[model samples]
Target: MKKVLVLAEARDGQLRNVSLEALAAASTLADGGEVTAAVFGSNAAELAATLGQHGASTVYTADHSALAQYTPDAYTQALVQLIELANPDAVVLGHTAIGRDVAPRVAARLGYGLVSDVTSLEAGEVFVRPIYAGKAIQQRKFVDGKTFVTIRPNNIAIGAADASKTATVVPVELEIKDLRSIVKEVVRKTSGKVDLSEAKVIISGGRGVKSAEGFNTLNELADVLGAAVGASRGACDADYCDYSMQIGQTGKVVTPDLYIACGISGAIQHLAGMSSSKVIVAINKDPEAPIFQVADYGIVGDLFEVVPLLTAEFKKVLV
Candidate 1:
């Protein structure tokens, strides 16, 4: 039996979906032994019940002014201390911004083997991860000692919450000091309320959208479906959109329930980010585009004409 601990994430007081996914992944690594979760910041106690419902036997929370916003110094300090206190056999975290930054720091500090970007797990310790820009698969395992892994967002399924379960919330304080930099405030430049990583649906555009103004139509379609808007590197390079909206190997990897590609030529780099989506719908004039090969549905036409039609139709069905 394995004991697992997960570093959960939260944003704007509410728990991020990836945190629940991390709990689910932690439960998997525990294999019926024990699963514990850790949340940092002011909302830890407030979020413990939800963590319990998802199978966290114990929820550890650290409340500190430095942890109020994510500073690597404060977060790493707290996580390393928690791991030491719990002495868990394995550690799990969501493959998100915080996880990407802090997991390696903690593992390096603790001298543990760390596996990142894990999409699937079989036989507990055996982890399956994507390599070479999603063109290949790599399976690796930790033969002995503690195991640490970061699971990709939307790649793992979450178990339904149990109302009967209760988790013990422990408040911890870390000796966080020595600040090289402090994030006093954060300024966001995102288009939608739904996070691109956790969105169930996405409407992406490429250079074929012509200009930044072209994205307006895609946004209309996205608004109707309540989907996030994404862009290819080509569009970002052309200055048609911000890099935050870019979806490719160089950008964010997403696995939404539905991905609609508009005017994208389907470069390998772009495909690497969104290929894992449950359903792909490609809209491009070229019937020979590589995206068609992976798309469950394809529309060959001008996206300007097709997108508005899709938006109007969806308004009748979904909105």
Candidate 2:
């Protein structure tokens, strides 16, 4: 049987939603073959069961203190062994920080072809990815051995409950080697807000916000709507906010159920990050703002007046 391997990601012993999405994609491509998922961390067996709920038939786990914190060497070594043992037709992963770092390394080690940031995957000789910062879509296929693909999150929907199935956990052996690079410490961002990548709704501010305080209105509106906050490249470049909040060609990509652009000019770079949003609402004083072109609903008006009204209306609806 042609097995398909999916690398799962978890935090604090819980599976990431994107990892489940990867499992969903792999299951579809498995073609009746075993859909196996591998997770590295402590108490990963429980996470393996979660994968089963998403269609993973077998789950491989490697638990160790070194695996607790992301050490590329340790993870690569573990995954390398798993791939060799399972011999999957294709290995899939979430295009996150860890996946981006490890997928290429795994491909290089196996001397196989890799397609990164795939927005869509189908059972064919070819794979698809975005180019020119999402301005273009390109498809390429490998004539060589097994293919490796890292899928961008939010591009695909996750699987619903299948309580009849449960993922079987298989433990893996590990060889701890001296990593050339050692992680000294990980300083997490202090923000208590939901991660923009995982957020279902994102309300982003841009140059139209006009000031650092301008983000305050966006925040108020976001709070009422129960959404995460984001910023545009133009807003970040103008020093209205930190780069971490920036979303554009050079920044993090987000695809939420609803993406609200307040004052953003909607440059191609900015659109690349958020064009995938299911429902886009653009509020700009200038009707010609490029962002309005893609918006499902456009409000050409001053944000200062528009945002407060939105916040108030949403507050009432939410309450």
Candidate 3:
């Protein structure tokens, strides 16, 4: 039985969905062993009950004002100390921004093999991840003493919560010092309605979205579907949208349940980030657009006309 430790991530005083997804992945990796979840931040102890329902037998929380915001040095120090205390056989984290930054540092410090952006787990320590802009998949295994992995959100199913179950909460105190940088404040462009990475449905636009005004249509469609809005690199480069909404190899990776591509030419870079979505729908005037190759449903038409129709239809159905 392998003991697994999951780093449960929280943001804006709430737990991120990817953090629970990581716990689910940890449960799978544990294979009947104990699963412990560790959350770090001020007042993070309040999250223990939610973590327990998801399958964690033990929830460790570190509440400190110094740990309120994420700083690479402070987080790395806290995680390293937690790992030493738990001495888990495997450490799991989400492939989100913080995980991508801190997982590598932890692995390097412990001299353990690290695998990032894993989409699936096979028997043993083997993991599956994308390569070459998601054109192919590669299988990897960790033969070291301890294993560290970062799971991509939406790829792993979140376990059903059992309200009857409760976890043992352990509060820990850590000495955080020598912080080179601090996040005094976070400025957000979006209204903080939904996090793009964790959104179940996403509507994306590309260079074909001619101007900033064009995004309003996509946003309308997204609002109807309760989806997050995203753009391809081309759209960002064209100044039609902000880089925060960019989804591609050079930007945030996502795997939503439903992905709608409006006027996107489906560049390899863009596809790399969202090809893992469960259902892909592409709407473009060009029939030969590369997006159609991977789309579960394809519509060859002008997005200007098609998007509004889709939005209206979804509103009727959803309302």
Candidate 4:
């Protein structure tokens, strides 16, 4: 029986979907042993019931003013204390921005083997992860001490919520004394918009978008589908979109359920970030565009016309 500890992720005073997904993964890895979830943030204790419904048997919360915003040094310190107290066999986290930063620090401090961006788990020990910008997958196993892993969101199916289930919530008190960095304020680019990494559907544009005004059509389609908007590096470089919206080797990685590439030529760098999407749709006038190779569905046309048609159709269906 494996004892697993999952680090629950939350943002804007609400739990992130990947946090529950990580809990589900932890439950599977536990294999009938025990699954504990650790949440850190201001008022994070309120999320205990939700975590329990997903699969956590016990929830540890570190709620303090210092933890309200994410800072690498502070988060790592909190996790280090939790790990020392629980002494779990394995520690799991979602491969989000915070997890990517803090997981490595905790692993190094605790002398644990770290596996980042794992996509699959087999027989509780073997883990599968992508290599070389998702060109290949490699399966790895930790031969020794505690295993620390960060799972990619959307790859693993989330467990069903059982409202009848409940977890024992434990409040952990830690003396977080860090003198290095702190987030005094957060400036958001697309505030209140769907997080690109966690969105189920996404609509992205590329250099073919021509200008910033071209993104309006994609945004309309995204609004109809309740999807996030993204852009290729070429689009950002061309000043057609913001760099925060860039999706590629140099930008954010995404794995939405339905990824619509509008006017994107599908450069290798662009594909490296979103190829893991479950279903890809490419819309471009160039029939020989590289994105069509990986797309489940392809449309050879101008996105300015294609996108409005898609948006109208989706609005009708959604309404």
Clashing pairs in 2: none
Q: Alpha-carbon error at 137 in model 4, in Å?
A: 0.8
The lDDT per prediction is 0.91, 0.85, 0.91, 0.91
lDDT for residue 180 in candidate 2, whole number 0-100: 72
Regions more than 4 Å wrong, model 3: none
Off by over 4 Å in 1: none
Residue-pair clashes per prediction, in order, are 0, 0, 0, 0
Alpha-carbon shift of residue 126 in model 1 (angstroms): 1.6
lDDT of 4 by residue, 1-319 (tens): 8899999988877889888889888988889999999998767789999999998988999987778888988888899999999889999999999999999999998899899998888884789999999999999988878889999988888999999999999999988995498889999877368999899999999988999999998988888888999999999999988899999999989999999999999999999999999999999999999999999999999999999998888888996
Candidate 4's C-alpha runs over 4 A off are: none
lDDT over C-alpha atoms for residue 33 of model 1: 91
lDDT of 4 at 62: 93
lDDT of 4 at 269: 94
* Per-residue lDDT over 80-159 for candidate 2, one digit per residue giving the tens place of the 0 to 100 score: 98899888999999998898999999999998678888777666645678888766889887766787888888887898
Q: Cα RMSDs of all predictions?
A: 1.1, 1.8, 1.1, 1.0
Q: Put down candidate 1 lDDT per residue, 1-319, tens digits, no spaces.
A: 8899988888889898988888888877888899999998887899999999999989999988999999888888888899989999988988988899999998999998899999988884689999998779999988898878999999889989999999999998788889788997798988646799889999999999999999999988888888899999999999999999989999999999999999999999999999989999999999999999999999999999999999999999986
